[model samples]
Target: MKQFREEWDLDSIYVVDSALYSSDNFQQLRQLRWITLVTASLKVVNILVESLGEETFEDIEVPGYRIASCCSDYGGVRQRWLVVESESGRAQ
Candidate 1:
């Protein structure tokens, strides 16, 4: 986790998101409905792979991408999106 914090900056390590309460288009959003959640790369993709048995996936779907950008200024793990290398057979 220390490695991630240093590499992703304090914002990515500590994220927050704002939600406007009571908008005409998003009436579902309300001050009373506000909540907070926690998300970390190690807690997400890493954990998912772990649940699937990392030993079995070593030859399968390895992490072919890296965290190109993470905007903790947005919300949750919105910053930890997958990135495809230019030479890789995938979309950017």
Candidate 2:
């Protein structure tokens, strides 16, 4: 990320997967103005379930999908996270 910022002189948000969920990476990115859309890992999902329970999720309407979100902290930075479910995803 530092390299991307320094070399390209660009500051853009990235929608990332669980691979970028490390605290070190987030801490670095947070310093920049890079917004991250990280898919929640099982550990994060479990913590949210344990801390806030299911009551906190609010329904969100997206074009063709049923979505829901909850606000929580990730790597000490507060942000909203979304969860999408499908039978095939569960089978994995």
Q: Return the TM-score for each candidate structure.
A: 0.16, 0.57
- Cα RMSD (Å) between model 2 and the true structure? 4.0
Best by lDDT: 2
lDDT of each: 0.31, 0.60
Every candidate's CA RMSD: 15.1, 4.0
> What is the per-residue lDDT of model 2 for residues 1-92, given as tens digits with 9 covering 90 to 100?
77866776555666565577777787766755544555455577767645653454444564333345777676788676665544454356
| Worst ten in a row by lDDT for model 2 | 57-66
Deviation (Å) of 13 in candidate 2: 2.1
List pairs with backbone clashes in candidate 1. 70-79
How many residue pairs clash in model 2?
0
Q: Residue-wise lDDT of candidate 1 within 9-90, one digit each (tens)?
A: 3322333242221123133222122333323333444454334432332221445632232223232212233322232643
